[model samples]
Target: MPRLPDDFDDDTDGFDPDHPLADQPALAAVARFARMLETIPWFSRVGDRLDADDRAAAEDYLSALGFPGAAVVPVGDWYEAADCAEALDMHSLSWEEEEHLRAVAHETALEITDEEALDVALSHVAHQAASLVGPAAVLSMRVGGLDDEALARAAAGYAVQACHQAALVLAAGLGAEHPFALKFRLYERGRWPVSITGESFNLF
Candidate 1:
């Protein structure tokens, strides 16, 4: 039998792996975000051309947040728990202050393009969004009482909408690997607010 790690997500809802899509939100977000990136000409053109220091900083931020490696741990594998973690990797941990700045620039600014010349840039955008899933899931699983699959589906929806809003606002291509639903949800629009049961971060 597999000795599952403590952090491994045992989906309370029992998401089926044969239909991985049933529980995989990050994959969907990546796809959808990638498509969004293709729609913007700016992001496509300026893809992945960051200066060394900036790139290092961005990589470190994500690494510190978490990424896969021998020393690094998997996000939603056999044994992981839902917790706010400080563990991060060296790739993106090179600098901490620039994390948000880098995410915003790669995701929302004129640097994002839809040009074929920036394939690597498009990939980076997807990677960044992908990085968010693990951390987001960790926060969500305990707070929202969800597993990776449910969190993923929710994140996909949220990410797509967020990216869409950002795209319309900035007029740039945002890369993602998984495509998301384009429909509007009443809850998200503030037309269907739910009653809070306790002290929480107010996850939907």
Candidate 2:
């Protein structure tokens, strides 16, 4: 019964609270994307760390987006979707690039014992990789461009990096160790890859 601003379109004529503005196509697209992200299995695990109020708020936000159920999906299925491939910009890499990235990842992973250390290392490696030849040098290893040995090394490298990054975030007061699967999503969004074989990125 309350009035919405000029920015919002009335929902009665088919109102969608999640996307009250009909003109902002990008926001509408983000609403859809958020729906997909909420369905990711690890999202709930991440949500479990939230306080009751935060959890309730998250649920309300998702419900408003028209995804009241927000069911979780298998990691593989979600990662393999056509949209994911597009989002990931799946690609291949040369053996030389793979080797270089693996070596860098190996060195960084060796000294990291916790998430904070790992995050700093991840940043350093990403910066170095970017300076070399952009993200493809490392991201290629996640999209089917490396041999088994190379891929293993690549995955290990990124896994450690992701674990560390997630740790830092959790310690910053979330009070939980994030699962590797969830961290993997964060990694990809940051342009880091999970594997060259489209497998789940796990630390163990």
Identify the candidate with maximal lDDT. Answer: 2
Task: Evaluate residue 88 in candidate 2 and report its C-alpha lDDT on the 0 to 100 scale.
Answer: 37
TM-score of each: 0.26, 0.23
- In model 1, the worst 10-residue window by lDDT is 177-186
Q: In candidate 2, what residue range of length 10 has the lowest lDDT sum? A: 1-10
Clashing pairs in 2: 11-15, 142-195
lDDT of 1 by residue, 123-148 (tens): 55545545553454345444434456
Leading candidate by TM-score: 1
Q: Per-residue lDDT for 44-110 in model 2, tens only?
A: 2211223454334333423432334643222332224223324332353322333443454345444
lDDT for position 117 in model 1: 27
